[model samples]
Target: MKMSDKKEILNSDKAPEPVGLYPHARRVGNLLFLSGVGPRKRGSKEIPGVTLDHLGNIAAYDIEAQCHSVFENVRHVLEASGSSWDKLVDVTVFLTNMQDDFKTYNEVYARYFKDNQPCRTTVEVNALPTPIAIELKCIAVVDG
Candidate 1:
């Protein structure tokens, strides 16, 4: 579909506004591509206890919390795409500490995708935006 013809869903009142040069979610044809979601709370600093170096200075880096935040952002994006978690077809997880959080991550990931889990790829990266621990991007099929 043409850019002008494509439909954009913006829940400015309920969802976090786009922070960069992209929309939160957009639907084109039968596919929806959601931007990678960070751990930042809606219109607020990221929830505490989501940092890596906890004992030193409580740097906002908690692997479990980051996973949940990413999931929450994915949920919002899916809802905006006229679908829900069940419609997801693919997912890409980015993390800085894959070795340390792989098991815990899978545990939480399973809750969101309890049946027919979508195709997924997990990659351990050197770092992420703002040096966060995790990021998630989703793709879902949109129903007419």
Candidate 2:
């Protein structure tokens, strides 16, 4: 099949707009690849659980809140792409402060993927495009 015939762009109003030039997710054949998802609210720049100083440095943040928002955003993207949490195959997580936040993030993540846990890799990153505590990039397989 032609490339165009096997791919499609996915978007959801429930998720925030991409920080850069990209769709929320793209489906190639039956696999859906989601862009990095931050905790920013849909249709707004407000990031839950984030508190920044005057200079925009993170003063205090709640990793649990960020995790919930990020997963909710991922859920919206998955639903838009004709998939669901159970269909997720893999997840790549990025954290700004792994030492301080990994435990809380993991606790919240376990609540989301309690039964159908996807293969995951979590890594510490210097920063994210936004000032959020965490971000998630995921892949899922859609039903034919």
Candidate 3:
């Protein structure tokens, strides 16, 4: 088989537009690598649960809302790339404020990953590209 057949870039119209120049996920062999995905709504710049100040700073945010939306965004990318929520093998979560958000995020996460629990790592970061509070990087298995 040609080398090209082993690697494919996958983009989902239903997912939020990537903040950088990257596909939503890249398929390599039987695995899919998802770029860091935020909770921005598709076809718009609005970030769920984020209320910005006049100068574009995070005034207040809801971790629950962002968590739910980001999960949905990941699901869209996974399904579009020939995978499913149950196939997710690993996930990396980045939060702007761990002390303030981790509990809420984890609670929301448990509801979503209750059945297909994937290996997960959550860390606090200085900030993400946008005003959103959370972002997720994920990996999944893609079966032929």
Candidate 4:
């Protein structure tokens, strides 16, 4: 394989920079591994579509908005590595409240991955960065 065949690393100015010690995604061979993305906007802690209720009940956040944020992050990762959603193979979603959020999550997820829904698994977790509800991670095939 020519040196040009080497994997490319991607970062999008529109997406949040990796907060810890990692890049948004890394290319190895023909695969792109995207790290978990949250509702927080890139380079900031502002949570889009988040709202609160005055009835002593936390008004539910917009699952679709969160989903869109995740997808945008995914898109940046894929493009950074010269890939697309079509090349995705698998996804894993970490939910702080799967029971209440799965339906909404699926609704938005279906919109982006309508044709070929990649293999995926959703699991409930104990905590997340903030009051945000869900996060998603993905692995995709970078077609040459």
- Please give, for residues 33-130, the per-residue lDDT of candidate 1 as tens digits: 78777666786655534644655434655677777777877787778668888889999998888888899889988887887599999999987765
Instruction: For residues 29-114, write the lDDT of model 4, one tens digit per residue.
Output: 77888877777787676667777566533376877788788788778777777788898999999887788888999888888899
User: Of the candidates numbered 1 and 3, which has the greater lDDT value?
Assistant: 3
Whole-model lDDT for model 2 versus the true structure? 0.91
Query: TM-scores, in order shown?
Result: 0.81, 0.94, 0.96, 0.83
- Flag regions of model 2 displaced more than 4 Å: 2-5
Clashing pairs in 2: none
Predictions ranked by TM-score, top down? 3, 2, 4, 1
Comparison by TM-score, 1 against 4, better one: 4
Q: List the residue pairs that clash in candidate 4.
A: 16-42
Q: Per the 3 Å backbone cut-off, how many clashing residue pairs does candidate 1 have?
A: 7
Question: In candidate 3, which residue pairs get closer than 3 Å at backbone N, Cα or C atoms, i.e. clash?
Answer: none
Over 1-144, each residue of candidate 3 has an lDDT whose tens digit, in order, gives 754369999999999998789999999889899999999999998989989899988898899999999999999999999999999999999999999999999899999999999999999999899898999999999998
The 10 consecutive residues of candidate 1 with the worst lDDT sum are 9-18
What is the C-alpha lDDT profile of model 2 across 15-132, one tens digit per residue?
A: 9999889999999988999999999999887899989899988888888888989999999999988999999999999999999999999888888899988999999999888888
Of the two candidates 1 and 4, the one with more favorable lDDT, higher being better, is 4
Q: Taking the candidates one at a time, how many backbone clashes does each contain?
A: 7, 0, 0, 1
Model 2, residue 14: C-alpha shift (Å):
0.8
